[model samples]
Target: MLVKIEGIVIRARSFGESNQVVQVYSEHLGKLSFVARGAKKTRSRFSALTQPFTIANFLCFSSGNGLPTLNQADLVHSHQAIRQDLLRTSYGAYWLDLVDHLFEEKEPNPGLYRFLKTAFDWLEQEKDPDILTRMVECKMMAAGGYRPILHACAQCGSEERRPVTFSIYQGGFLCETCKHTDSHAIPLSDATIRILPVLVNLPIDRLGEITIKEETKQQLERVIRSFLMEHVDIRLKSWDILEQMRKVWAASDDSTST
Candidate 1:
């Protein structure tokens, strides 16, 4: 079957000496894996289109059993700014990895596709990548059906709780009354708690309108990481690299401060 679709490149790997195998998360087809012939060659037409994070329109022939063969590709957005910057690339790579793991092949999710495209646009425009990443993580969790309950206590469903903790195992916040339900629950600051739902549902376009304190952002990161670890089974290579880069950046900052 011949199909034309708009998609973002999620994964790309060398197949043969010259061909490349690319996995794209399409706006209409969800995720599709296709082989781009001679894409590894410097002069190949598909070379740039097969790159990670590139959003493009693709024409392909699917056999219904094995991988599809990419016939032609036209660039919509190369996201060159993101590709050139290390920090943006790390966040972008993690988002792609998360999407690749969260959805099944050929399952159309137009909502996710739109969200991802917007995220890339913002990242390229120099939005705070850390905040953007956190927002995307929360949104992705919600899309994957692993949304953490923050509106009320996950245990008793009460809205009048004074102090609450985040429970990864229980899948949400626990009121002070129910804190004993999970001894492992992480204590959350009022600020962090207040921002959780906002991050989960905030429109990407309005991300610049709000500012998050550094301390609260760190707390939210830990909570989101723990929640994802408890709920999602996928491992991300970009996350490890991003952590190492963060450590190096911290060391550099410390040196500059001293």
Candidate 2:
């Protein structure tokens, strides 16, 4: 059957000497892989449209069983700004990898598809990539049915406690009284605790209004990373590379400061 799909290219790779395989997360069709014949050549029309992070409308023939064959593509947004910068690309790649890993093929998730499209648009606009990334992570976790409890205690649902810590194993905030349930819960500052829900619930369009302290951002990163590792447990090559790049940059900064 011939269909028109609005999708964001999540991943693309060489299929043969001349063909390219592109995986896209569509608004109505979820994830679908398409074979673009002769897309490897510079003159091929599919070459640019098949690039990762591009949002496009695709015409394809679907057999409802095997890979679809891409017939034509109309560019919506190339998101070239994201591709031109290394840091942005790293963060964008991580988001794509996370989405690809969390979602199953052919399952429609319109909310996630819209969130991803908004994220790429914001990234291309030069919004703080870290903040955008954190928002995406929160949204992805929620979409995956593993949203951490940030509004109240995960163990007992108490909001009257004075101090709280995040527990990866328990899957959210633990009130002071319930903190004993997890001996290794990570203590968070008031700021970090306050921002957790905001990150999770805030609308993507209002991202510019959100400002986070460096310390709080660091703590948020740790908590989110631990939560994802404990629950999702998927290893992403792009995330690994981003970590390495951060370490190298930190080392360079330390050397220059000394």
Least well predicted 10-residue stretch by lDDT in candidate 1: 159-168
What pairs collide in candidate 1? none
* Predicted structure 2: lDDT: 0.89
What clash pairs does model 2 have?
none
Residue-level lDDT of model 2, residues 93-121, one tens digit each, is: 99989989998988888988898899899
Residue-level lDDT of model 1, residues 1-258, one tens digit each, is: 999999999888989899989999999989889999999999999998988899999999988877889999999999988889877788899899898888888888798789989999999998888898888888888888989888888999998885479998998999989999999999989898888888888888899898998999999999998899789966788899888877887798999999
Poorest stretch of ten by lDDT in candidate 2: 156-165
Question: Which regions in candidate 2 have their CA more than 4 angstroms from the true location?
Answer: 249-258
